[model samples]
Target: MKYEQLANDILTHIGGRENVASLTHCITRLRFQLKDDSIVDKDKVKNIDGVVSCVNKGGQFQVVIGTHVEDVYHAVCKVGKIEADSSGEPSGEKKGLISAFFDTIAGIFVPIIGALAGAGMLKAILSLATTFNWVSPESQTYTILFMVSDIAFYYMPFFLAVSAAKKFKTNTFLALIFAGMLVHPTLIGLKDAGDAVALLGIPMRMATYTSSVIPIILIVYFQSYIERFAKKITPQAVKTFLVPIITILIVAPVGLLALGPIGAFVGEYVAAFFNLLNEKASWVVPTLVGALNPLLVMTGMHYSVGAAQAVQRATVGYATIYSPGALASNMSQAAAVFAVSIKSKKKDITALASSCAATAICGITEPALYGVTLKLKRPLYATMLAGGIAGFYAGIMGVKAYSAGTSTIFTLPIYIGQDNSFIHACITAGIAIVLGFVFSYLFHKDEEAAPVEEEVPAGKTNVELNRNQSEVYAPIKGEVVALENVKDDAFSTMAMGKGIAIEPTEGIVYAPFDGKVEVLFKTKHAIGLRSNEGVELLIHIGIDTVKLEGKHFEALVSVHDTIKQGQELIRFNISEIKQAGYDCITPIIITNTGDYLDVIESDKSNVGLDNTILTAIK
Candidate 1:
């Protein structure tokens, strides 16, 4: 899979592997903890062959790679190295407050989401079996499935220990040992018996660490430092065996006797605090998350809320306010996509909106936000308003979730609790979706089409200039062909942005710009360039000429060569190219056209050497 190259490219693109503070992967994405999320080039990464999409979610820059994600992940690890996980030191200054906060929460929570979801589905299946009488709840099949459902929750500390170990740059196996000691049978037995045990005469109060969240995470954090110290002091010859032995002797007693119980108590108290909020100030949590979620999502701060929910679920068996509100928020965003699809005047926008909406409903929102709603502006506002309203109602109704999964409309059924308020909560969520759709539809107006002005602007005299501007001239000369005529949509419709085509009188090509040559296709059919003025151009020598390989072409300049305007770059054997039965269609495109607007092609039927074929307006 060329993992080394993939990792190098990703590291360089993300400003370097040193800039990453943490890393993890989900079902279809690699989540990066970058020092500065703003440095990520979403569009450039999306264009990479293996990447299906790129998103900033839960405070992580996620690159979606469909089913082959593991291949890409291995490639990333190969280039960055496995030890890169422990390199938590930021390569640069800290990110902004919101980004940092979100990153922290995402770091702590995203790793567990997959385990939790898998466990939840198992539990759901077990429930269905018991409900339908397919098997008695006490039967072997039921018991096995029950264990599968319960293991993820019961051994959550072990899972967290491993993930947190990676995040803190500690020994993952050692962290597991630390986790094991906390949840060991002897400790659980002693704690259940209400015994006050002394380890090395240091008095210890024990509590159940099974299903616990924060204690092991904190323990591993301390273990990272302890392990590093152990490695340094031990002789290199004995280091392999000495490091673990010394680290365990020093860390286990201290963690079990001190740190573990303290973290457990803190988690308990936090759970109690939230329970109090639910009992007395229930509406506040939902109201706040609902009101601010959209803004949080916009700046990528919403992952903190998800982290809080994970902590809440692990401690008290339920999460308050945020999960249901997140569900509503995502559904509202989906609704905005639908609204735009139905109401947008442009045919292209309508198609884009519909496709993005479907992707959002399936649990990805970048397409909906970046591709559609954010561009429209009004839809974004409507989504926020609807989310806030839903949150307020959910808080007042005391809506809660018992499991964690992707927050989306289809997952709404998970929120249906066995309580009277559950029905009302469901109704409120539905209303939010309707309100969001209607509001966005009513407020949004399509952007006004730019007025088309003729060349030479009505009656102005056309100036014939013999002088060449520093601007890149078109390599081929003919009537400008719109990008839509191209076969690939990624290149056509200027999704990669604008350029024109030229039908050549001869199969020879001239340099379009005064710049360093960047790429010469192996097939000898396409050339990419970066002009001195920072313009990027791709001159594809002939339509579908790639089929002929280099059979009918000869290059005059190699890549990296600095060539002047009107300099011969390639000589195409015109008669031979035609004899091979290929159209001599040439596309001279501004590959970086997104950086500029109003690229004007010269009004000419034919052009000669030194003629103005194209003009780029910055």
Candidate 2:
């Protein structure tokens, strides 16, 4: 795989697998929380073939991987053997409680945000459909869709339980059970009752827990402590049943009586305080939120506000301050990207700006904020200034969202029909977009990414520049398959350019086209070939087999050696490779793919040595 070497190099420079505490990825970067960030070789990582750059932000060792990060993320994780959420518990270089708190909350919520966004979209679409009467309110479609969308929110505790348990390093099953007890049907019936329900003669306070946030978090956090304590006292002979029995017996009622009410109380008071500020000084909330939004996102403290938003929605239907300012900030960021796209003359810079603009409009601002605005500096100033102005306008208009979801264009329907606020919200959003564009265009000077003097820019694995057809002979006799269907995303996504992978029947690797050997890996598992037509090619022997250090392979030629089509390049012992437990599906790739218009793989299921397996279109 093209990314195999890159992954190995990245893992090595990031202090190896042992130094990594946890690994996660956003759209453009691989966010690694390391056991020690001091050991990272940042310059070395930046210079790696596929890596874009590195940043130390929000206590994360962020290695920018561009659009093909998914491929590299999986490759790194696969080689590193990191499972989902398999981070070590918080202990290392000491961080304050505040940093740890925000980090934990963001970590738990970020993974489930996609599901949350999808549910929000469903709700928004349902509202729009019913508003216009396109779908009958009494119909099964509406009923089913409504329930599907509402289930996530109605049982927020259950979802939070699973995530919080993971963060707390406790039992997920027991956490789910704890959340279940709070929202149990029997408990709901006694919500209005003046008397407390007796659980084994202990008077337990009755509280409604559906859609509750803080209660379950508190329960799970304390559950970790209680479960450990119970296990310590219980004997190994009866530990399985008795430990859970005693832990639940203690935590269940105590949670319902003490932790449950206390957590919910905190949520209520927080909402009350915000509502209080909203009435007294309306502009303060929006202006501050808008100005600090990009900063909040950068540090992952935005999710703290997200938690508060959820709390406000559950306690009071609709949220006013957060949604309005968040929308303004997001749209303003989009407008800044649009401004940058319009001002830049370079195709690559313009293309990057255009893509970031799309994501920004969809209510995801990280791409625009990090990839474009913050990097350029002036666009960021424009965004912050324009965002505050727009936020002031939206806040004054008293715009609020009735449904609980991010303020994406898709979820705008939720803002409609709330005290005839649709027109106001729409107009306010338009102003934000226009003003953002104007301000950014004025403040930001035209700028472009650094120009490249090479045929294909360095750090780009491949580029597709032209499509003049050229035959690529088969390098090995094997079963031919489409490149897009390859198991590795790097090859399939054309991130490593384009070509096809083969399930080889033989171990010999032949020269596919007449060229000089540009470079050969020290491990003898891969080689780079540059054809006379300037088509750069890579032939990787197998997935992650480079760690073998040339054990089962032999190279027939060295770097700069003149090679002809059908000439033998390398020979491997297939049986020995398989005995070492590695898949030997070889991948042939065009590394300068971006310079070509397209690299087309053969349609045939099978091919012989030196037969045409691909056609590179210039």
Candidate 3:
């Protein structure tokens, strides 16, 4: 509801799209990497119609929109024209080395993770059927299901090639050609060769590319550079044939000789690193993952582990390190939401809690995360703490899944038909739910308490004439015009109630015969007041000054303060507002226009804070 206004308000409060380098969202928040952080008004953003909260951390501007974050994110993207990461590509402008590295990982992994999840779930089902003796291992049905589930992983290089091509902006077919070489039969057969194979008289090492991760990515990255250079050197007439030719010629040998081996080694090292952690400090894996899974899910970097863990499972018999923590984390989140559902009496909160609980139980945690547990803030703490405990238990019990898939009730079959690990998995989930519910139910009731209302002191204009007629003075010195002429649709269309607009000659706003300051935005770019004669007004300083984030403004008064005509309401600097590229056309409107029968406007061409801008008539 009111998504357009929410989008507009969000865009404005975050310093406009020009200030944004790029944008992304987790389950609940719009993560914006802004060009200038100092220009954002965090408080004003939190007060926007749809926003739940605002946070500035790790060089990102976060706007929490709860469950509908995706909708708002798309709306913001549409308004901003950001080439976002449904492609899972890092769409931000230049970032520091570390940020870029993480961004790249998220981009490359996000697009493929869904496919990975689907295949993993399929494998889990196949495992279940075979375990139950419903399908024989040698049967055609089992073979086909196995093929569908394993093919993606067996040929992960090809899929990664497509995604990496989009990220690096290279010729996709060229990248595929490069991936083809890595998994070619000759290369596979070369693994059994007694000696190194020669390519163009250069010695090349033999390695398995099936179920591989990094090698193709490296080759494709190099291929993109070669393709880019080839298009530049070759004639446009012969570009089509020449580009692929040059790319293959350059990428093939170097990939075989250097990058492929390096990437393969890197993948091995990554897997070995986790294995080392598992052996030396088994509990650390579960503890760290359980504590940070929610955060990892938000940045979308959790999928990065799939590649490394795939290598682990292929090299070893099963994936042990990552799955335990995932199961615990999911169960704990579900339990937390369920606890909160019954604790609250509010229908909306209860409905959200119930739905999210069901979602988490099925292994999809986004709903529980954004709509219920995290929304309340306290339940998240319970989930995290409980998850850590459950994960530690899973580690101690050596819980393992034959294959890595999402942690949900549906995935329980993956843990079954293995050694006693299935029993341990059940125990871990049970502990997670029990601990999560108890702690959350115990500590989360404070947020459900009824809010106390605050009374506004007298002195706000209530002296209604026979027609409830009142004179509203101008808030700023500027040219006066009808509200419909204002640039913003919310004001121009009178959706925010009828008002007059001004193209101010000065930056300071004076109280327009103010009886009380009903509202004043912390950003100081806007103010609301009730004049001594019962005229209510909403004075917005600029067309989108909300974007300037109070950079050029300062509040001179606070809410509920009584004031006289010509009293200074705010002080602002137009230079920064102008530099930031916002129109400083302010709107002064009657918020309760329906209360009066006729609202008459002034015929004056230009006026200051002393001029009567509108006459509210009843």
Candidate 4:
């Protein structure tokens, strides 16, 4: 119940769960790959209480939810009946290769990033401890702690296999077995001993795979197709055992000999190229990364950079490329947002900027980026410029992050090394913050604003419908009455459908929404309509007034005629109906109330024409 309303609202604005092709959450956002981006009500979603902001980029509809996004993600899964960790089958417009790659990368990495960060942080702390002699490296405590810290990174393929299997929608155990095969003691010993290993007479490229990233991902992707092909040929009688057997038999040799070697070569070459770039110019990559980081983040190409950085880390023990530049960029964003907080006069903007700045400083930047920097425009330029300058200094100093986690003030320990790299990283962050603040304070020009009253459309109510729901508007100006108080048993018992009775004063009925007239009584006293969204409504005028209904009532729309909201559908004389000695309390019934979870009535005792009086909740 805590997040139920928020979940429902989010699903409603995103065109319901049916429109969602897949859903995943990162550190601070719920990422949705949607089938129809056009129908999403982004403004409504952004205005939801728990939602910080909404973004559409890189084929994803992202709802920023702050640190507690996991709980909210679970809530969304529960409400939508979606399986946790289910990477749904692809459906929708075909994505470009770049978009698909980034999407795949995010899906595989997002689930494990928190654990990876924790493990990385532990390794960083151990590095700090050993460097400071707080614990001797020979101590048993140190040995165990070091082992614990290094385990996740050393056996990284095992972790990657699970996440990759989910992303590729393949068998997880098979993927795990594949990872086990790569990291098996026998294989590692073979590689260590410089022995040429052959499988089924095929010579294997004894590439080290314990800490490898690309190989397992490539293998799992290949296995997804091989597994599907295996399943098709295997007889159902032995399908369970034979399918996996066939898959492993086919996948093992091909993967080890071809895919694994190819992936390792690609990873090595990419890392080598980046190293060469750094060796020749030293500052070009860092400077460009810092300046373009925000744009990269917005396009979700940051994940691509992160993937390359992961490969670099797997190849070496530390990262000098992406993490250093990202640290500078993150700190710069924090400083720029802090400047905004100090400069803004409005209480809400100041409060928001202050909180976002704090979050950005802790290594999450989406809130600050979307809520403050990008919204203000100038702050983004300030941050990017500041980041670029800081990154150049970091590059020149040869600052390297010794671990993989968020780049933050607290994680600065990760930069600790045998050289002056740690101090240089600190100086880099300081430079970013100082330059970011000064530039933002100077460049920012607040826009003069004026309050504008919102205008409501003619013949419409402000009340909006949620998912699987619709609003029924008052057709005539009248005093609202409870349905139970009506004279009719069918309505009083809710047998006709859930609705409310209104005592009519004015007697013109308007169509509630775009719909078709399904029924018009010859007596002209009752009308039945179905909305475009499938809300079936019956508007009955006066109790048993059918005795003299045709005498005072006139139907403007005929049966089966299409009508629009606010279009006149009926006209009646209230005085004549009263003079005829009949109760003129008109009841609007949702004849298909069973189709909804609940039908709720507006609390107002009196309603004006076109005002919302009933809301059907799905």
Candidate 5:
């Protein structure tokens, strides 16, 4: 299937392999850890032939490639030689508050989605078995399968440790060692003893870590920093030996004695607080989550609530308000997708919107957000209003789920209880769906079709170029060179949308066309311009010239300032620049080449000033 080609294409679209710091693929997306996030051309990646979409979610830049992600992942690994799960020190600055929050929830919950799905399916099968008397609940066969199905949920901390360690860039093996200490058989035995055991002159107070969530994750994050510090300080001669010895020595005591207990205490307090809130103002919690959920989802902050769910489950064995609100919010999105599919005039948009709606109902919301709700802004508003109404009802009724899974119509049985509260919850979900459907349908407006192109009059004269009219002139007259020959791909690929490159004949650069200066980088190494004829150009002065501190160069224009053709944009002392050990090869290319049909480069071996260099055509 030419998998290598696809990988190469994807790498090119993302600004090449050098731009990537790390890469991993999950069930359906290729996640990239980029060296410079700003260099990532998301629109270019999205428009790539094989890509379904591009997303930045949960602190990871993701490219959705559907089910073939494994093939692409293999291809990427072949070229980069970096395994998807290898642990290393983090490369960039610490993530922001919201980015960190979402990363934590996504890191914790996404790994569990498969487990929850498989467990839910098994429970469904078990229900069928018991209902039809195929196997009694007491049967040995039933017991075995139940244990298999239940282990993933019952011992969730072990699974969380492995995934969280990867996310935190810590040693997974050490993290497992830490998780084992928390939930060791001996510790469980100690708990059974009721304060009977002591080790190393300190009394041991053991609590079951199985089925718990937050404590181990937080501990692992802290452990990553400690491990990284140890690695940094240890001398090269015996660093490997010294690192493990120091890391274990430092982490073991702190995790076992301090962080673990503090985390547990915090979890208990939060659980108690949530219980209090539920008892005092249950409706308020759900109402707020519901009302604000649409906004959160739009801004990609809804993962915060998922973290709250994990904490709730670890402390209280059930999540009271958040998931129910999320369920309604998701249904509202599905409704908006459906409305767009029905009302939109464009056939392609209708198909995309309908498919996105179906996908959203099944528990994935990206397609719905990227393809529908956000596309038609009014539908998003309608969904938020409807979700709030549904959340209010669910909260008043005290609806809760004992288990976590996808919040969809088919999983409604999970919310059912023998009490009237269950019935009320069901009615609330139904009304929420209906309200969303009504509001979206009423508010949605059909998009107008694009006008068809008309032919120009035969007598009309237009300036024509044989092959060079649209080609970017040498902004700085120099010997032309291919971008790939340069040291840095980021600088090399500045001409990505516009094709070709040139080694400057001289260091002084002139404005190629009469245009307004859009951006003059602070470092004086690059300039962006929009021509009066509507061409967008990026003239990067030199390879890695940003390191030169603007020496030997003087800028003549500021950003947003207008300049005429042949205007002196920047003056450079060519020999002085070369003596400073800097390459003066400059790349001049069109930044908005996508709007043109073709860009043809001139065939001339040596072109003079004002000579036709390249041409763009419709």
Candidate 6:
């Protein structure tokens, strides 16, 4: 609900719910398949408060929302009244093969990314535990944890089946049945025993499905068309059960005989290609990933590299391609931002840069990449140079990560398997940070530092400034809630300045004092007011009601309209808003709370329209 307003803003600017054909989300982005991309208001969406950035690439309109993207994605689905679909397949126009490929891979992988990362990290933790002899491998604790981590990779086809079924728009349960067949214990036993098998006298090729990726994806894709064909051929009356039976009967043998082996070959070839490249030119992948990751991230193509690494891990049980270089790149970005934070004289820029730098070091680099490095052109170059060199060093050292997770300083435990790999990774990170900071600080310039004021002239004495106090009355009849208790972090943390929330019992909002509306949101759920007494306040009608897109609410006065205390300002239908599943908890905030010594909330639990709610003391 906290992201509803942001979702609504995005939906509105991106040509509304109708323009959205299908929607999905990854770790940090809302991937949208819009019906008409040209009509999207990119600037408006990029400027939305919660959005980190916006990208139009891989045939999708991607809204970057950092770590909380899943929340925003659900909010978007609810607000836009659109079903969240994993099939980000284009519904409007055909796209280039590369774009289509990226979209397909993203759709198939995005849904289970959390599970994949969690399991990978758990695997790494298990490796660390055993390596350090903290837990005996024969212990039940180790056995249980190992199984927990192994299930994800061991049964990867099941996970892939579900996601691919959704992406290919096939019956998910049916596809799951197919995956079940592929990894069935009997089939696994036969393959393990090296026994020959045949379907109806035709030879069936045996290939392992456990921990496999491409075979299931190809099977599910093939299932989609076969399922449709089954539906068309079977009578409607018997279609329910008969269709599945017919589709499975036909596709099963073919998949085992042809597609399964073909997919295996493809997967093997792909993995072999990367392994060969790593073998022949070990520095190439790391240097390229290090230098170009930012560009790939900006275009939302980084997922492809991640998918390749996942494949490599599945194929060979270890990978050294992506993570090492990615670590160097992330560290470089962190260092560049930290350098900017240190060199900048402006408090706001320094604060922004410092926080973004910390986030980058934690391995979520989008904040630094989009917010700081990309904005300051020189810092991006500095990071690229630093990352490339560090990555080259890492490659030369032959560092390898034994697990998968976000590349971060703390995740170096993943490099524990290979002797000295963890040490090389650390050294690479150190090099990246040092070079990035030095290059950025030397090349990038901030605004000239403010000149120091001349010491107070001895001839002049400072004059005392007078202070004034003003009262802000209740804008609506409600049970008052302290700002700290508000659900929203922006309000409860006083990040948007001091404020008090209300659980409104009525449907109307009135002017708290004589004031003019400085700004009114298009959704009419919030307003900014400037009182005659110099108190600037913001009145938000409900939590996330902006998603209603102005429905169930009407503004009596527009922006710049002057009004007196107790005059009607906004009239909302409380019943209707509640029916639509929204909390009508209005927050009356002192936007300029810093200008006052204190903005005290009323002690009274309940307040009427005329009751004093805030006292702004200056």
| Local accuracy by lDDT, each model | 0.72, 0.79, 0.78, 0.84, 0.71, 0.83
Write model 4 residue lDDT over 1-618, tens digit each, in one string.
Answer: 799999999999999999988787653468788999999999899889988677786577888775467689899999998777534321222459978888898778777778778988998898889888899989999899979888888898999999999989899999999999889998889899997889889888989887889999999999999999988988889998999999899888888899999989988987788778778877887787778889888767787788788888888667877888888899999999999889878888899999999999999998998788987889999999999999899888888877888888889988886788789999999999999999998888778856545455575444432344688888778899999999755467565678999998888888977888887766678788898789988888887665562778878987666688889998999999999888899888887888999999989989986688988888
lDDT of 2 by residue, 1-618 (tens): 768888899999989999988887643458788999889998898889888677785567878776467689888888888864423221222349988887777767766667766776687788788889899989998999999998888898999999998888889999999989888887887776566677778777666689888899899989999989988998899998998888799898789879998988888887798788778876787777776788888767888778778788777766775777787788888998899899877787689999999999989898888678987788888888877887787777777777766765557877765576566667667777888788888877765447555354454433343224667899999998677776655456656667898988999999999878886765678788888688788888876575466779888997776688999999998889999988788888877777777777788899997578877776
- The candidate with the higher lDDT, 3 or 4, is 4
Q: Model 3, 603: alpha-carbon shift in Å?
A: 18
Task: Score residue 199 of candidate 5 by CA lDDT.
Answer: 56
So what's the TM-score on candidate 6? 0.61
Model 5 misplaced stretches (Cα beyond 4 Å) = 1-90, 124-136, 196-198, 229-242, 417-422, 449-618
Residues 344-415, candidate 3: write the lDDT tens digits.
777888888999999899989988886667657789999999999999998877777776578876677678
For residues 1-618, write the lDDT of model 5, one tens digit per residue. 478777877888777878888886543457787877787888888778777677774456778664456688888778766665434222222458877778677866776668866775575467556756899999999999989877776777788889888888888988888888787887787788787555566665566677777768877888899889998998889886888778778887777666777777777777788888889888887777766776676555665576667667667766765677877777877876788788877898789988998998886877787566766677887778888888888888888765566666666545543345446656766877788888888998876757545343465433333222354565766555555566544334432455456666666677777778876655567778887677778777765564455667778787765677778888877787788877777766676777788777666555555654556765
The residue pairs that clash in candidate 1, if any, are 3-75, 494-497
The prediction achieving the highest lDDT against the true structure is: 4
Q: Total backbone clashes of model 1?
A: 2
Candidate 6 versus truth, CA RMSD in Å, comes to: 16.1
Query: TM-scores across all candidates?
Result: 0.62, 0.60, 0.65, 0.62, 0.64, 0.61
The whole-model C-alpha lDDT of candidate 3 against the native structure comes to 0.78
lDDT of 6 by residue, 248-336 (tens): 99888878888888877887888899888878888888888888889888766778777777778888877777898999899999999
Task: Kindly provide the TM-score of model 1 when superposed on the true structure, using C-alpha atoms.
Answer: 0.62
As a whole number from 0 to 100, the lDDT of residue 545 in candidate 4 is: 66
Give per-residue CA lDDT, model 1, range 202-275, as digits (tens). Answer: 88977778888778877887898999999888999999899999989988988988888898898788888888
Error of 4 at 268 (Å): 1.1
Write down the lDDT that model 2 would get: 0.79
